[model samples]
Target: MGFTTRPELRGTFGAVSSTHWLASAVGMSILEKGHTAFDAAVAAGFVLQVVEPHLNGPGGEVPIIVTPAGADEPIVISGQGPSPAKATIAYFRKLGLDIIPGTGLLPACVPGAFGAWLTLLRDHGSAELEEVLAPAIHYAENGHPLVPRIANTIATMRELFTTHWPSSADVYLPNGEAPEAGKLFRNPQIAALYGRILEEAKTAPSREARINAALDFWYRGPVAERIEEFCATESVWDVSGRHHKGLLTADDMAAFKPEIEKPVSVAYGEYQVFKCGAWSQGPVLLQMLQLLADTEIARLDPLSPDFVHLAVESAKLAMADREAWYGDSPEVPLGTLLSSSYAAERRALIGETASMEVRPGSPDGRRPILPPLMEVGTIPQPGLGGGEPTVARDRQLPNDSQGEPSLNKEGAQRGDTCQVSAVDRWGNMVSATPSGGWLQSSPVIPGLGFSLTTRGQMFWLEEGLNSSLKPRVRPRTTLTPSTVHRGGVPYLAFGTPGGDQQDQWQLLMLLRHIHGGMNLQEAIDAPAFHTDHLPSSFWPREISFGSVTLEARFPGETVEELRRRGHVVTVGDPWSEGRLSAVAREMDRGSQIIKAGANPRGMQGYAVAR
Candidate 1:
């Protein structure tokens, strides 16, 4: 009802929303071609790897939540690749390193994005492999306009590329300089690589066989051979201030395959929210909902300090549980953690004032154990080569005090992920968060035109813990996507791009929509906030006790009120917080309808419907 950045799109056909306008258009185009939502999402996902190279690439990973039309429940496509067999805690300790470097070859994992997309296309989609990949190849071969952030990220990493990673320099630093913003940029090497794969796939006799052939080319054939050769021979500079060879191998790639599993769901009133398993931070959102279920969340004004305090406090508890228990291993007691009784025990910790301590609750009488915390001033800052790609904060901190890597003296600019959501006329829906292998995260592989993912940096060096560095195990990732079913029918698919802030922002939007009666655009457009009270999932793993960052659009009185409640509040520029996008489907008078919304921040996200 109030002013929105744009209208919440509504139609009787299909809807698509993504972090990039070009990707959204690509998804819309696939829908126009009469393909399924799975096809549209696969096409748009590949396009994002080309257009938003600073955020994601073919070498990264993605976690997708999908519900086919008339399906009983949503399924999670676990695209997160595991660590190499050689990436053990002993191996890192032998190298005299206490933590994995945030950049370079040493932290490289088996790139899973390509295989994951192929799997989605092979199993659920109705489009051909060539059709699904044409948009991405066209953009990569010809050119696409560079967003300002991509240009800025390249400019920031220019010295590192030119001086150390020449393969990266050859691809990114065209004409020995960073490409200007809004200018056309191309990566013909990636285009040629996909073209070769398509050609190889064409040798197959059937559509499914073609997709499987492409998968083999990427994981067991030439692509894996190239990556293995490079890692075995080349030593590259990284955030450790030293050159190191990677541990990944052709066997690691060959051994890995994306798995489709059931999603974890929790009931909230009439809605059943679903998220990926504990391998991701998705369940934290479910935990937050459980923590708030007993409170007066529906009666409180979403913009008031009361609502903000409750939300942030609940996030702190849930995120603490995430740090203590969530991982890729079977030891994660996710069921008890999401139990209503456990939520009640955790909810009892909230008071009239904020709590500064990091607290993890006991599940089923099990004593919680956490990874060793990194003390302040202990994390190394080896310049722009480290850290995720994000916006630079306005405030300045001393070099020794920085947690994540910063591009300049101003502050840390960490852009970690990208998101896409699609819903077709038949009610098929998909939500995916694709991230890692950022241009700044690692050196580009020669001739591949894309970099390896440094997701291994999320693992701690300590032994015996769930997130400890281990051979052939997944590092608990921060990339999470969400979906919801109203009255046991798939109704919504949504997600965002912030590393730790993904679930936090989504919590606010969901609370506002379900309780405050706000539409999708209104929920997204509302002032966003998040707590940094838990240890970060990224490199250098810093924790800021009682810290809360809010958009300046929040009222001044509310800011003061939060400070009064003992929250260490930092107000950021208006529209600087979230990049969430969502698409939904429902029936109106027995006629199917599609609805969509996208974040207005960064002027990049778009929603299309018809």
Candidate 2:
């Protein structure tokens, strides 16, 4: 694999899949315009929406963790749109509509990304929206090179796009086909939208007024109405207004607010661990670290048999806890899961050798363990004749006449997400995993320039489980944005997108670097393993360790040892679809060195630190 790593020369560092050049140019623009870390991230996110709309958009929810200098409290922003006030648990059950799919308006969460950007700018930004958004506006109006990856993805998904969204096809496919690599791609419609925001910002008297104006432009005025009209015509709108109002009415859009809450923190050895709440999978990272800390990992040779065995064992234990206990805290004991006693108890289970079978435990609960949701007794008819019922469960392979499982079946499609990280000149670090659920419905909306997320597809219709995606309920998501700190200072900012494999990939990288004493890039470059045993977004336990290697890297004895431990292991593609982006900074006394790492699996990312 031709892997590349570079030092970010400017004060800021950023990476986006498929367009490192575009990301770098935008980051430079933010710095040249004198924006803070938060401001630049918000700016970069907006631009990425225009360029990489397949992953996220201005209409999406954005979860952010920001640490500022000299401040005891880190600024945490929750860019989540709420379930419409009318939405209730009873609503989904009544319609017999419970399966979660990655399409339609079902997964829309009040479009928190824009709200988050507005919040960041209102509080901490040095420049106005016009200056921060100038790069994206310019790119949209003029154009940027159409990279091969983007062009190919567009071509591959074209049929789905044309079938589901005629309007989206009009813009993305300019000449009966997706644009080719190096072709200058432009969106005059999105450019016009940006122009409107700027024009409104100029007329506003106060900063808050200007921000509100931009928010209103998208949420309340012509834009909001257009969204509603599309949903209504498509008949995707729930007429009862029981679930979140379709396409957001003026009231729904106007009433939406961004949440700022203190991050849940735990002591992972000497360093304090912080993460976005259980509404996301952020807490899993901390749990994995804490579990590893309780083990004698530092005593073992870095890649020796003894070390890899313990590391994998520790990871499984931690993942078990995550599967059971990590979820939305509003209805669950989120804080309790992060408690010291909880971490210690979970950690105490790791053994130097391996345990064959993974012990299944129920999640900590206020209620007795609820049975898995009832299987659909009958297949309800789709509201639209052409569409099918959106079921979130992994489809099982059919059984043969002899009652053995058949391998001819395939899985449902999921969307790709973007993760970015940066370490500034003064050593302030920021990491964000902003993603959209698979672009279930393509050509999402005309002139919108992107697809709507099928995030709703991640939820279940079941009554009691953590994976339940009821009305007004947030589904269990894998978008975890994390920062690792050592000795009371930020050290690493990293995140990845691989559905359920995200946590496993990140956990291994952290241990390799921190406990195994490898450099940042080395940790990322090292061969890694992921399991499919647990309830990740997908199924059949995708054990990727052996699937990637043609040559035997581990000793035959080590492979035998792992088998004795009961892993249904497979050597996997080293550059499996999982893509992790990271920027690590080592600071001693007054000096600091920052190193960035990008997976070699994809060609469109880079790392730079001055």
Candidate 3:
């Protein structure tokens, strides 16, 4: 890591880092105004929807990890709503499909972002709802610079929108062309929608009442009405080359609200790693830590092949378990899986050479159940590439884009998300990963100014699996946010936006930061790699056993050495893989100070501290 672009900033007041700059600034402004960390995170999350629409939308879901100052234990705010009451595996098969297609309205779930953000703010925020959402409304209504990648993303789907989703064309192609890079871009309709919500919210008697009013407006009122109406009357083509109608209903929207639950955590070394439960794919990271609990990870060289090998192998094992045992089920034997005894038994499986096989272990005598079959017929890319807008095309491995796949995985293949982490003076910390509802994924709901999420695509048609689709159950989603406490104090709030690779990339940075003695920026700047060995949770699931992709920046000698170790390697450009960002808070003397770091790979992520 020669000369990182920025330092791991250390400051006395507060810090915020996100996948985009303006979002970070908005959050920082909120913090500066004496608002809670929850308010800053919510403010930033909405800004992300306006700025990175190609990656996430108001229609997406978030699994947030919150560690309020003075709280004894961190909690997970389940922003990911459950599947529609009609989103049954039987319904998809009835439409002549074995897997839910990656794109189109048929696979959508109730929009969850609004409800979740509001929940966080209602319980934790110190500012008015309008104050927290003001930045996003301003940008979306007036105008903001169009990121070149977003322009390119829209260009890829230009044809599809023109042909099948004219409502989308009306918004994205307002001038009959994809908006040019860095040009002033505006979505007045979305701004107006935000304004209307705020106006309605202000009429309520109290802050909580205002939030509830806005929630009702979005979930059970006009927004839901438009979504249900559009979905009922229209059908869109999916990756399977067929069209299907949406299964979501306004009742489904009205029935769902964000839930608060205890985080699933494990005490690893001096830190306790906290992540959202299995309802999201968060516990996979905790499970990985459980397996590595006894390993001498802190003694290894961060860039050494030996270190990378162990991490990769451990991830393969844990992710295999994720496929087998992890899901949205309350019946999961999480206690047994995270036990030291289980780690000992599972640790025995890591051999010297790479294992191409997908291995899932038994915990407490329960056999792991896998998807009936991981579908093929399409090669999955790292980002969204299966959609018509961001068609599948190999670029570079460390690319920032999660292309919209016309044919790909629903969880990781066809979708991507946005991430935010913020810590304010009062000791409140939050890490949120909001994603889904790519512009190319579904036709825009007329008058609503946004589309619903295609999160239902993550559900499997097969039964008896932990992630199997059922009415009113959340999909085993890939959106995961994380919090880490050092020496029994909340120390760090961090996360990224890659689909299945979220934890993989995070593991690399974390191992470097905690084990190898590297600072935040230095650890993030270090070369990263991930294995696609497990069956993907996305639609048209694909597995790449014994496969490894490395950033080309890794030492040539080290790269060659790994290939000789029997790993199938694909070398990618340096600075391409992850968009990891983080903010840390700690006690200095008697006052708490904050530090921040962000990924430079995408040229999009930013960290602000003051």
Assess each prediction's global lDDT (C-alpha) against the native.
Answer: 0.87, 0.57, 0.81
lDDT of 1 by residue, 485-508 (tens): 999899999999887888999999
Q: Given candidate 2, what's the lDDT at residue 39? A: 65
- Give residue 115's lDDT in candidate 2 (0 to 100): 75
Over 174-246, each residue of candidate 2 has an lDDT whose tens digit, in order, gives 8778888788888777778788878976799987788878888877776666665655455342212223324
* TM-scores, all models, native as reference: 0.96, 0.82, 0.95
Q: Identify the superior model by lDDT, candidate 2 or candidate 3.
A: 3
**Cα RMSD for candidate 1?**
2.8
Rank by TM-score, highest first.
1, 3, 2
Candidate 2, residue 376: lDDT: 22
**Clashing residue pairs for model 1:** 389-414, 389-415, 390-413, 390-414, 390-415
Instruction: Report the Cα RMSD per candidate.
Output: 2.8, 6.2, 3.1
Better of 1 and 2 by TM-score: 1
Please write out the lDDT profile of model 3 over residues 315-380, one tens digit for every residue. 999988888887788888888877878988999998888887788889888878887544233554
